[model samples]
Target: MLATIKNISVTYDGVGKSFSSGDFISGRITLELGKDCKIDYLSIKAKGKSEVRWTERHNNTTVIYHSKDKMFSIEQFIIREQKGQDCNVVAPGTHVYPFTIQIPQQAMPSSFKGAWGKILYTLEAKLSRSMRISSKARAEFPFVSKADLGSIPELMIPQHGTKVKKMKFFTSGKVGMDIHIERMGYYLGEDLNVVVSIENSSSREINKYTLYQKDSFFARGKRRVSTKDILKELGEPIPPSGKLKVTKVLKIHQHIVPSIFTCSNIKCEYRLKIVLDVPYARDPEIKLPLVILPATQTSGLQPPPYLTLGLTRRERKPTRMEQHTTISTAPGAYPPTAPGAYPPTAPGAYPPTAPGAYPPTAPGAFAPPPAYGMYPSLSDFGGKSEWEKR
Candidate 1:
């Protein structure tokens, strides 16, 4: 009798590309045979595969596929990377096969931490029905993790923290570091053009560096990719700031489409930080404020956040106090300029969006510029017409 089977399910044990012990990759399979043809064995298994290669600069030593397979047990090699592995699934299955593989902490691949290339896994099902085989069922998935953005040999200067500290006894400060980009951004990935510079004003021959960064969206508690989303390079040394002017051109990939984003509030606007790695030293401490700037878009086009309200925001009009910036910060941090509401004779803003082009004003005067911060949050602006104009 001819037999048939379909709908095989596959699952991954770990949520992240990197995993520790105790995680299990499991799934199930179904089968059907000509009524009571007496079915038998069904087998399920998991496998992993990886291949890598790296070459040093100036024609130095090289490394290739550092890891191939590991002795997880007496006879199991974790079936690392099987391109032709299959599942011999069958009817009347036996043995649930509580498969649990070992994934040592060191097995975890990292960014710029030495390991590079892709790691993927698949399932192989073998079946024997009444001393015969029908077909095989299986599933495959990818484990992708990017490599480090820069080398470790060039790391020097301030390594971490946000403040630029200088010893009180020292009249001036001096230190430096270098940063380079192997690729401006990813080939088919969203990337940001970045440039960094550090200067030394002190006379001491200081040499150590640190780097730190806080992406704007995260600080504002908004929805965006985490700062750790991209790979970075913090190596290369820097000379005294006065002695050498260091400049690096590189790209950062968001690994997502439309990578460019923005976050703002009532106070000073914060940008994406291309933080530096400054090692600790005595005396001079150089502090730098990283700024995030978006690329030029088609003229007259603006991000939705810049002109509309998010799902969490409710529609509302500007309070008289908000326009004048007279509200108390103690009670509530009221904003300055209201969205779609411009200040009259504000001296230089495209003629105030052509007065009356927005919501109508109250009877007379445009209520002098609000006294708070001379800016408004992207959430401040909202209207059906505004969205329609797009």
Candidate 2:
């Protein structure tokens, strides 16, 4: 009888099977055997890698350039034979094996699909039989390692540049172009404002102008660049010594990845390229550097709080009367004593001595005062009070 891999099912921790770097992927593999079959071993393997390949035709032969990097690999054996014994022969039934693997966190590139390059993650189950033939089952998935923008503050700042080029080789006439942008950095779903001015002193007529946003990667000692056309405008034929100005807003797409800078072996960058097409003449091109950030970092595009109804906000200031009223209406504004009443002494305490009376002397106790001598005594007033004379 023949042994075969029946099916493979991969399950992740979250709601979907999709995962990111540093995530744990767990799944099960099922095998079916028609009859008793001897097997060398059963193994499951997981791998993540990136590959780039393209072919160029030389004089009569084709030259191919290929580069590949393995990000991670993990393998687990489900069944193995002893040193002196043959492979295990399983009964004709279904067998299930479970596996879990943790993806590496360091230097993990985001998944990509391109015309000549790809980053892929795969899981495979192998059933090694006694014969040369082996039954295998495989599955593929995507992983994303998000590029963070919070650490690089400069990327959020605005950037601008200008370039001037001659209309054709060995030509006296030149075309001066200036490109200005509202910011150097942007997140997905945001709009980028671009201002361009072209001063054409050349004799050739400007036919059209195209703006391209390109993502470039330098990996494995080779450079690969991909571009998406963001904006295009038909140039109004500029006569000799004429000028043209344009202002446009381009929307960033969510499918694009942020600029990558952490990896030494793999470098990713973006540029805004402007091409001015001249009829019957070499096109003049300019490149402006750009930084792409994560969509979550764009606060302006996020939803506002539920309590706010998306209205224009104004700072509210308290009036003088309102300020005074708040303080006056407070619960503990006044002291504990009643109005127009003397301040009370401590609880269960005695009052101070009278104006002309004294207290009995005792250790650490109050002392009695002598007769008045600073001013006229009460006897000098002829037994009448000073107030009566006044």
Candidate 3:
């Protein structure tokens, strides 16, 4: 139990949403040998292993996956012969480092709950002639959205025209495809303001229109978010068209997906399809798709699910509350001791009176003092006034 161990660690250069399975890790492990060295060979190695299991309810059958574990073990170096080296040389100190391990896309589970697995990577030092110490670094992995990880607006404005259907106009849009303005927000707590302009290029007075917004990521076949789903999140009625701007003000109450998962050289993308539902109807409920893809995922990352919170619009309560109060303490009774408060005064000192009326003489305001001085002045009978009375 009291053996010297090598230092080992695993880290990524990218942050939260950008963590990838293909990122590489590089580090070293050192071992120190004492006085007299080893009698056999020695080296360092890395091993990976994992197991997954699940039971389907449809048939009550358990599906077992035992070989899901992948390892990356390598013999750091073998020392077979050397001049009769000191213990430090024979059992000598050496380093056993590690390299990067790429995560397979198929292995990445969707972002849904109950679809997850754990992975472990370890490194150890082995010596044939003697017992040596070992060390390992472990990390937890979650399967993020596995689809619709790419694309943009170039698909919006079709060169010729937008597809018109049952109250819907669809297109990736010509210029709206790749607007790289950081100010366009989409994550939790972010307010997204977007404008997709369609100029009846057809010289027709489009009477009705409907729009549906989709999560860009959904394009790749992952999960997709529906405008209806977003509306549900809003809990209110939303405008359909003409000039409609969806301002999503964030209400941070719980786990609002704080980050995204990605690879080292990956850039995620979102897509939008403005469905001018009814050909001529001016305003109609429409749909747009938001997509997320890696810069390299041109083939595209799968998108999330189509979702909406079903939010509706309604008139706000008529007006502010009508406030009225009855004071328990007399008006201005206690004069403010601090700023904004009146100074303390006896109850009813200041009675309600018409504008120019004189003070009603606060009740008991003129209480006459007890009569005393008129009876006899102290100076008048100071010396011997008592003698005469005796």
Q: Can you give the TM-score per candidate against the true fold?
A: 0.28, 0.56, 0.30
**How are the candidates ranked when ordered by TM-score, highest leading?**
2, 3, 1
- Say which candidate scores most in TM-score: 2
Cα lDDT of candidate 2 equals 0.52
Residue-wise lDDT of candidate 2 within 170-273, one digit each (tens)? 55588887878875567777887778788988775654445455444444355656677655656456677888887766677777765544322233455666
> How big is the positional error of residue 223 in model 1, measured in Å on the Cα after superposition?
42
| Greater-lDDT candidate between 2 and 3 | 2
- lDDT, candidate 1, 11-50, per-residue tens: 4443344332223343333333332322233334444443
Which runs in model 1 stand beyond 4 Å of their true positions? 4-22, 37-40, 51-118, 144-251, 256-390
Clash counts for all predictions = 51, 3, 110
Model 3 root mean square deviation, Cα atoms: 38.1
Q: Clashing residue pairs in candidate 2, if any? A: 158-183, 158-184, 159-184
Residue 163 in model 3: shift from native, Å?
14
